[model samples]
Target: MISLPLFSLLTDVAVLAQHGPSDVLITGLTLDSREAGPGIAFCALRGTATDGHKFIEIAVGQGLAAVICEEFPATMNPATAYVLVKDSAEALAHMASAFHGHPSRQLQLVGITGTNGKTTCVTLLHKLLRELGYHAGLLSTVQNQIDEEVIPATHTTPDAIRLNALLARMVAAGCTHACMEVSSHAVAQHRVTGLRFVGGVFTNLTHDHLDYHGTFDNYLKAKKGFFDALPKTAFAITNADDKRGPVMLQNTAARRETYSLRGAATFRARLIANEVHGLHLEIDGREILFRLIGVFNAYNLLAVYGAAVLLGEDPMEVLTILSGLTTAPGRFEPVVSEKQRVTGIIDYAHTPDALENVLQTLHEIRQPSQQIITVVGCGGNRDAAKRPIMANLAARLSNKVILTADNPRFEDPLEILAQMQAGVTAPDAAKVQTVADRREAIRTAVALAGPDDIVLVVGKGHENYQEIRGVKAPFDDKLILTEIFAELNK
Candidate 1:
């Protein structure tokens, strides 16, 4: 569908290869050989666990016009064009953008980065933009959308070729705006290198991805890359309430806009009223009511409003659109039983900060004599340091806590529960029970909730699959809750 000439898009053929110049017209770009087609250029990227270089020959044999590899092959065929690059991943992003005629430049692109709230903020912006008469697209952990059709997402941030392809699709579909969640891993790995973001948002940063980056400083640097690459015309939206927000503001080349729920902010949310059903707040001196609960979501809404304002939308208009916005899948998503006396919530609060924020928000709206019970677990092979912290927060906040397995990939589920148990030192430790099966955990948590009690199922929010070892099994928190709720009513 893209009509750009392939020869014109090759910026560094010599860097990618030491071979001769060929008159091959590349029609597409890809990193995986399985996805490569005729006339496509293949990028051989070396990932942490898998090397794409191993598939160079297979790609070339499968009718690829050119192969971009980290190093030139000693036995490459003379007929096949080879380009050598120092870093194939970065080169792929740059070349893919060029090949797609730089579709990101044609649209108003916004990139939001943080440990949490990125998906929620991006989804909110997408909804607001559509209500404001702009055709909007979104790419996030939950799903991918271009106008009306929704596509399943394979990664938090997709690979370069697929990313450009998606952008081209959006452009073709007449999308005037798009919002994307820029993960720290995606930024560090050059996943979004060539795309020009019109606005960048930093929600907040916490201790996460220590296993991948090795240190907190490295993680911060990776997140800073999003704003550092922004153009001068772009706006950097930051959370002034976060301790690291000031530091992040200092690192950007783009203009700055700050939003916060606490402390002084350019766009501040003054809580007018809080209830279990929704929240009422005064944003930027304007009283606005929203259907989203929790103080954390108030921050998320502020960020969404700030970015919407940067795009030239009216504050009240944005608020009106958000006031009608429903909860994202599994993010503080509420479930009701037949009698509708008990309300259940499912959220992706795996970290200590996320858990504390969600629980505190529930406590604020809870009725007198009502209790809050929680079900949560820590993922295996991730930052094990946060397990005890999350447990301590849950123990201190909730009336009851249930520990269970959350994607215990290649690690014993019991070991993760043991680490969490260390932090829960209450005499009512008996209130906290360990369930290795997530489904059973959810059923137990829901069954224990009284008519006035609110139950929360945390971690693995919108995800429909449970990863164990290397396979992903079918599982969805929302689906499970709906089924259980139906049975309870019967």
Candidate 2:
């Protein structure tokens, strides 16, 4: 544990009530009261759903080094110190960084934020840089990495304490550069408050996480907030094709740069060929053949390529390394049957825009005789506005659509399927069927496919567990699809 005097780590905080020693030492920091131990400082954060102030008393009783909150308790332990902060979350972030030795400043940190493509962009960049001989680290929804050591990721952006600890581990492991997906939740909650980001990338903005933000404008503000607070020394990279891309850099002090496929930008790419096998692109007058397919992935590649160029890497080598890179798991990953010529594609397309992009990519490349069958579902405890929209897109794009459950946390599986089925109109009703069981839905889709047919299993791409009623049971779409294919092919 790293212990420091209270004054040494204080940042814009005022001593409200000091009962005993003012020179009391703080050993560690935590936002959660359960983690409060002797000599640990507890930060009482006020959140939308729950107030951290409710647990400050418990921490103090447990012999916490100090109590940090916007409001001090009426009854304070005479031996424990109480400190007041303007913002509890912000103070926690600064405190966590100070306790961890400010590891972000020791490495070249690039943050990628948007509605989608964050995971793929950061994951690919990590792979690309590592392949180029740099000791790189990655933090994405899929996993976390410190050079060669892989750690399972529990959140898109971890809490301030955990984030600082992870960055410290990266620094200790001698990572030269690190790229992470900066979720909007992490931004609004002040998770990355004290971290220094050398660069930031905006992939795109769309309808997502409305369940938490409550409106589209609020969601946009949360994403734009990341760019707005960037330092002048850092670079702000955005997708030129997105309508809100330019708006993201409006108030930023950072240098602005753009990457696009449809318009002129600082970094630009053109699609030479988009086949099922892969995409051939003409990037900055140089042609590149990439193993990853689709227009969405094309945009992802441009974002990664642009960020690399902004970091002062060789343009030719970036493109060359980019061409050899493949997508992260569950992103347009294809598996074919041995006995039959049928193809099955896996993707994490939960949002309407993401779902449409995957389906459109398939329609553009498939043969006229091939029937496109899709198995898709919406996640529970999320933005419900996109459920019907996802259902409508599935019906409009595929010849046959199977609506099923995807991590129906507390909600009933049948209820979730019914909500999606509500989008099926009279004409669209003929192509749709409801199967509450996701595994059965996949089996049905595969059974219906002919030798030349293509099946698309969309949603929950890389996720291995199915969360139902708060229990995570073992369920992997990729593994299940492969097992069914082997059984059918034999």
**What digit string (tens of lDDT, one per residue) describes model 1 on residues 66-175?**
88888886688776678777888888888988887789999999999998898889898998898899998999999999987899999889987778889988998999
Highest TM-score: give the candidate number: 2
C-alpha lDDT of all candidate models, in order:
0.86, 0.91
Predicted structure 1: lDDT? 0.86
CA lDDT, candidate 1, residue 487: 84
User: What TM-score would every model get versus the actual structure?
Assistant: 0.95, 0.98
lDDT of 2: 0.91
In terms of TM-score, how similar is model 1 to the real structure? 0.95
Q: lDDT by residue for model 2 over 344-410, one digit each (tens)?
A: 9999988998999999999988999999999999998888888889999999999999999999999
Error of 1 at 267 (Å): 1.8
State residue 95's C-alpha deviation in candidate 1, in Å: 1.0
